[model samples]
Target: MDITVYRPGELTAADRAAWAHVQSQAVAMGSPQLGNPFLSPGFTFAVAHHHRGVRVAVVREEGEPVAFFPFQRSAAGVGRAIGLGLSDCQGLVHRPGFQWDARELLRACGLAVWEFDHLVEGQKPFEEGATGTYASPVMDVEHGYEAYLGHLRSHSPKFVRTTLAKERKLGRDVGEVRYVHDERDVGALRTLMGWKSAQYRRTGRSDRFARPWIVDLVEHLFHTREESFSGLLSVLYAGDRPIAAHFGMRTPAVLACWFPAYDPQFSKYSPGLVLHLRMAEGAAADGVAHLDLGRGHKEYKESLKTRDLTVSEGWVTRPHPVALGHRARRAPVRALRNAVTAHPVLREPADRFLKRVGRLRAGAR
Candidate 1:
């Protein structure tokens, strides 16, 4: 195999066609995880258009592309999954039965350290490098919306009842409730971003929308329309007002849940949960098989997930001082976080503490 690197925009039409072919073949082989829009060429191109240092390592067999590894590199030879902080799914999109030495690939791309979180499972080459693995909750709607609703009703009868009751109350108290699955309105998109930004601030987390590049990338993705990938915005409206909204990415097989937020005044109505329920129904009807809630532990995730998928977090490093230093600094922090998240005893308290800090920060602001 010959490995060559190119900026995301530098790929020729033939190269893109080959890349898409590989991705399609992977999905055809029953690897739906590779169907994440985050791994699609559209996502890489969008990020590359708004950010610098993005590269794709194209591995070719007899000059035919068989694999693509998209990443962002720093001048210090450190690499990260393309759109690292934002992308929920990360991994190389490779043809079946193709394998390469991890270090060799990094060297070919001039990377000393490669870092990733939310890496798709079954990546054997990076398995040993992972410091931790976590369950990413998923909703299986392959059999259709009714089947999934039946599963949820059977498994979470009380949750379903309460959420639905709240939805009824929301409609009665506000106005006629309506849902838009693939909303085209840019205003709704901006409203979702505003709610999401406020949510981040209230939760004492760094607001991603505060960054110009991230905002640009998101808007660019919103306009992206491709066979294998597209940006999706779903909204729930009550009396002509959007009560909740989500901006996520979708492929034919999967709907990757990303940014979701609800109007604070309607918090009692649980609009976010309601929106997800509606999103699943719409996705199933649209022939999407899974709704990936991403790698995180939340009360709502626990209640809504039909099953769990494993995702890993870690770094791959070549034998270089820069690589060693980068791992040394990050490993301990990751270890501590993993330990906390792995046990409910630790996680619950940590969540409470963060909320308290968030309240204090918001009050101060």
Candidate 2:
């Protein structure tokens, strides 16, 4: 086997085709997450446009590409899965039974340590590197949106009725409801970022939209359209006003829920839920088989998820002084965060503290 590293844009037509072939083979591995849109080359291409640090490792067997690994290298030689925080599925998209040493792979990329928070489970090379695993919720909608609604009606009947009724009520009270599964309005995108940023600060979490690179990346992707991967902007509008929206990525078979927000003033109308229900309807109609809500827990995720996938979080480090130094710098904070997230009792208190801090920050501002 041979390995070569290059920027995402450096890939030739053959390289892209080989990458897609390998990714398609991944679906036979038999899990929805393995087929996530984030793992596709189109995503890497968009990120490469905004981030020079992005790199891809093409692993070949007998001169044929068998796998692809995309990551970002920081100045200190520490690496992270490309679009770590923003990407829900992370792994070396490869053919089944492919063998490679994680350490060797890192060395070839000149990375001392490779960190991943949403590593797809069953990735053998990094199996021993995981510090923990978490559930990633998903909704299998291959059977169509109505079938899913039937499941919801049998389970969370109230949730389905309330959301549907809210959609009707919102339409009647405000104006005719309009939904665009692929909205191209730039203003709607900015509104989503603003709402997401304010929500992050109000909840005492770091606002990702505050980072210019992330903003640029999203903007770049929003304009990108491809068969394997494309940016999807779903918006719910009342008359001429946007009320709820979601910006995510979708492959022909899967859609990833990334940033979703709604007008707080319409919170009583449950526009967020209405938007998601519409999203599912749109996805099913488009032949999208699954919707990945991503790794982590939330009431909405629990209420809507039909299944779960295991995603790992940890770092794979090659034995070196730089690796040790990086580990020492990050381990404590990572461990504390993992502990809090793993324990609901602790997480609740931590959440409350963060919200209080957020309130103080808002007051100061």
Candidate 3:
């Protein structure tokens, strides 16, 4: 096997095709991280305009590609999986039983430590690494929208009634309610971004939209179309105005929910909740089985989740002075994160402080 590395923009058409082929072969792959246009060369190109650490490592045998890993290298000798916070699945796209080893790959890339926060369980590279796990709430959307509502009613009576009542009131007081899955409305996306940014600031968190590359990448992704996975923008409108919107990716089997936001003016109506219901309905109709709500501990997620699967986030470090120091510092932070996650009361204040710090850092940047 031969390993070669290329910068993000330097990838040729053949490289992309090979990469896509590997991604398609992963059984647990979702469209949000692996197949979305945001993770494509064009979007990565836009991100490369502002950042300097994008690279791809490919392993080939007999002059054919077998595995591909996308990552970002930092001056600190640390590397991160590409689309870190924005992507749900992070790992090497490889053929079955490939010979790549996680630590060996990091060493070859000259990285002291490689970090990831959202990784699919049992995936290569991360499978044997030291890690911690968390559950991502998901809803099965296979039995059609009405069937799902029935299931919700049986399982979460109050939640279903409240959301449905709100929807009715929204239509009566606001206007006729409408939902568009795979909406072509770019203005709705801008609206979602604005609302999401406001929510971030209100919670004292860093606003992702403040970065030009992130903003542009999302816009560029919306316009990109592909067959296996497509960027989907779902909008809920009232009287021709978008009240709530969600941006995610759709493969044949899954609808991976990424970013969702709603106009605060419709807060009482729970427009976001209504929009999620509509999204679930659409996914079921389209034969999508699961709606991956992503990793988080929000009350809505818990209420809507029928089952929970564990996912992990951590680092595999090299045996070096710099790596040791970094790990030593990170140990306390990881312990704190674990403690907070186990106890919501402890987590809330710490999360608040982190958010404040993130906002300050954002403001400085």
How large an RMSD does model 3 have?
Answer: 3.8
Off by over 4 Å in 3: 28-50, 348-365
Tell me how candidate 2 scores on lDDT. 0.89
Model 1 pairs in collision? none
Candidate 2 global TM-score: 0.95
C-alpha TM-scores of all predictions:
0.97, 0.95, 0.86
- Tens-place lDDT digits, model 3, residues 1-365: 47788887677877876666666555454422343233344445545665689887878899998877777888888877677777765666676667667777787777888777776655655656556778877887767778778878899999999999999999999899999988997978898899998888766766899888788878877876765556789999987789999998776566778889999888999898899999998888887877888887888887777777666788777777777877788778878767887787897788788778756856876
Per-residue alpha-carbon lDDT of candidate 1 for residues 113-224, written as tens digits (9 for 90 to 100) = 8999989987888777887788999999999988998999999999999999999999999998999999999999999999999888777678899998888888888888
lDDT of 3 at 61: 91
Give the TM-score comparing model 3 with the true structure, all chains together: 0.86
Local error of candidate 3 at residue 42 (angstroms): 7.2
Predicted structure 1: lDDT: 0.90
Better of 2 and 3 by lDDT: 2
Candidate 2 residues 208-241, lDDT tens each? 9999989998998898887778899999999879
Please estimate how well model 3 matches the true structure, expressed as its whole-model Cα lDDT: 0.76
Candidate 3 or 2, higher TM-score: 2
What lDDT score belongs to each candidate, Candidate 1 first?
0.90, 0.89, 0.76
